[model samples]
Target: MTGGERRPVASRLAIRFAIILALALLPAGVIAFIKTDALESEVEARNEAALMGATVQAAMAETGLIRRVRGMVASLSHLTPTVINDPAACSELMRGVAEEEPTASLVAFVPVSGVMTCSSAGRTYAFSGNPLFEKVVRLREPGFVVNPRGPVSGTSVLGISHPVLGAAGDFMGYVVVSLSHNALNELRLDTFDSTHGSTAAPVEFWTFDRDGTLLTSNLDLAAAAKRVPASRPLAEFVGTGSTVVQDTSRDGQKMSYAIVPIVPGDLYLMSAFRRELTDVGGGLSAYMPTLLMWLIGLVAAGLAAEFLVTRHVRTLNRAIVSFARGDRRLQAIDLDNAPVELQELASAYTAMTESITRSEAELEDSVHQKEVLLREVHHRVKNNLQLISSIMNIQLRSAESAEAKTLLRNLQERIMSLATVHRGLYQTSGLADVRARELIPDILRQITSISSGPEKPFVTETDIDDLRLVPDQAIPLSLLLAEALTNAMKHAGATRDRPGKLRVRLKRSGGSEAILQVSNSRPDVSMRARIPASSTGIGTQLIMAFVQQLGGRTDSGEDDAEYHMRVTFPVSPLVTAENRERNEASSDKLGNDPV
Candidate 1:
């Protein structure tokens, strides 16, 4: 009848909820995993393709650079001898050429007689010990040569040898086009700005000749040429057509390159460009759209799952609430129209309710039969105890000696206390338990009535209402309180010489314990100390045994010439509710006060 009671329909709903959650989450998790793997693979393939394409673009750019440098040298040869020989006039002319083509490292003229001169910067020298220079001087006509250390004093330049003819058409000397091949470094795309204005990762460029001269580079030209892995065959690559060479550095792996037969006859133009294929947009902003899409998808999927789960929960909740309110006729909503597992749940619920009504009727009939049997047993026990108490009272009155009469009287009290509890239980709804608060007062009133306390003003006070304790707690509690009260009445009497008041109080302590306090205005010090000049009292022994059996504690003290006896014990609602209720009802019938 309490709110905490569970129904059969609730169990069915729990099963339904578990099934629905599994159905929703399992499929979503599988789909998400598959999508994640697919996206990662696609991105990797795209990255690889982009890198390879960038490498090919870099190689073609190098070949174009070499051709452009060759054209610049050809146009310079048309000047007259006066302009070529005059240092001041030639310096101005070569300076103009240097400004026009910034990639040209140097522009100078070399004579067939081995005199080397820088026509732009105005430094002059002759090739003496250099083997590359000797090779250039022996050539009789226009040719280009790789001179590691040429007729120029310090820097190495690619020598373009052409015959300088006199008026008679005889070769006077060879006019040489000495161009610093280091200018090939300008082809490096690493220095170029990207559209995003972010500089790309730095890359180095270096071109080395057969004699270990760095012909061109964005790095330290001379130092980088010396550091080239000497094992790589630079001469073989130049003898061949345009070649792509792969190399590596601390920054990244790269392609070293050369465009061979660069200027005909003796010259080869080697151009090196670092091939750095990296993401142009290396930041989160580059993938914002993709991340945004993923986040949107995640939120949408979560909301969809929540909507589906909440919808099913609402359907199940309605069924549970109806069952809790005892509406057995209410039908559960079908979830099969909702989700996969919820649909299965609906089928299960329908099947369960189909049989619940019949099962509930059978259970109710069984409970009613058991209750009838219990009530009959309680009625029989009450009758037998009453008969025994009556026989004890009759026997006590017939006893001849004073000691025998006292023993019989004590025996009668004990028997009557137990019978009183049984009598209360027989009248209660559930006969398994007696309410002690009701039983104790009835036993006391019966004792007081025969003991001449009709006008003694015996007061009964209780702080508990509707709380029940089982037969185990109620029986001992009833007998104990009855004995304590009986002693109080016998000693604190309104006899011819003395009169006193009796107080009986029962309450729940801290909502966890049952307490009974009986105080009487009996002033006899000998009785208070229980140190009689006589034999042991039955009241003391009986009260001690009852307290011990009930797992309770007893305290006795005197206040204002009144003897107070208190008994406190634990109560378990699970074991005691029915009996405590019945006994309290009987106590109400027997007492002058209500609590």
Candidate 2:
């Protein structure tokens, strides 16, 4: 697998998990918060309504008690002056009213003489028994009192008083009726309990006087009343509307207090509310569904991610392996559905593979063309050398003198030596170097066979190997060797009876020079210039030219009946002039039109 394909699953999973978590948490948390907020708002609305109803019921009940007591007082005030002057008749009237109206705790009638009398519980009481009656008798008009007592028994009640007068419109006395506070308290408590029982949260009922004095609450009334400051800010809201809400506390636990304004704003303020119902965020039940949704969504997204990652990696791996196996023609992997990084990886892989394919094709074509050109060059050189050898052979057959015939034979051998070099080049892929040891002996043998007459027994011999020459230097050196060997064979000859040996040894004296020495047992140095001065043999002149061209020195020596012709040439050419000439000749042969 390639580097991209080898990406670890742990990293990929971590990235995917992070994305899914973000997606799940951001929306789910927001929705849950909104839902919680909505629930709190709804609960607050319900609490407000409940509080308003409780406050209204308490106010109605309290006001009705005052009104009922006042009505009773008005009825008694009309019969008061007649009944009051006669206490017995007044007691009868008061007792009859009290028994009929069970809500009235007591009844009283006071005379203009400032004496009060009361009837309750089947007994009558005199006004002198209670000091509160004295204060009421001094009143000029009708009035109501809170938490009053009966005229004689001192029974606590909510009381009201009205004036009673004679037919002459003179003030005679007053009448009083008391309503029971305990019955009103019981009714208020029952209504609050009923309203509170129908709700999921706690509900409170608070009643305060106009000065914000706490009167009633679902909590410990006396304790709550003490905690409520006698002078509170609710006095400023005496005339406000019903159902005012604010987050507050009764005894330090958090609560929402809703203040409901009662009717007759001058009397008192009644409030009802709940506590410990604020939205604290995520209800446990709500999280069950939210978590389930998040988990489901995360799983689906993870599966999709795995599929995409696997597909992209597999495609990249296939393409990479194909390229490794020398198949550069693979198509690019398409990772559009995959991640952006994998897409880039695929594109880079395709570009690199395409580049390699083009380079390989170009290299292969270049090598093929080089091989073809090399083979063509060697073939042409072989043909040209053969042409030169054939031309020399034609020249030798038309020669007249024995000297010319010998020279012609030597020229043919020189051309043949150059042909042998071409043969080596044409036969092998490497055209530049020819093995000279094998090549020289083969050339000398050809020369001996061509020049030998029927009676002559000439043999070419040499102990030579491990020698190499480049074609450029070998051609000229071959010509020089051919000339020396041919001279020994033809001019320094032994007859059949003599059976003389001509020894030819080609050896390297040092690392730098090739030494060709041809020695014959028979000594005939005078025979070397047998090609006369008057005659211009082509081979003789060419031999001298080739020797000079090779930059070599030649010497003819004799010792002990052996004639030695030693020619020493540098291992390589002194200059590239010969190479240049060869190039020009090759070019001329290639571009020249055949004649």
* RMSD of candidates 1 onward, in order: 13.2, 22.4
lDDT of 1: 0.60
Candidate 2 local Cα displacement, residue 519, angstroms: 79
TM-scores of the candidates are: 0.44, 0.38
Task: Quote the lDDT for 519 in model 1.
Answer: 83
lDDT per residue for candidate 1 within 238-287, as digits (tens), equals 45654444454323435344244443333344444443434333334445
Candidate number with greatest TM-score:
1
Deviation (Å) of 426 in candidate 1: 2.9
Stretches > 4 Å off in candidate 1: 1-309, 324-326, 330-332, 350-361, 392-405, 429-436, 453-467, 496-498, 524-536, 575-595
* Whole-model lDDT values for every prediction: 0.60, 0.62
**Candidate 2 wrong stretches, greater than 4 Å:** 1-47, 54-66, 110-115, 119-144, 148-156, 163-174, 188-234, 247-250, 253-263, 266-271, 276-595
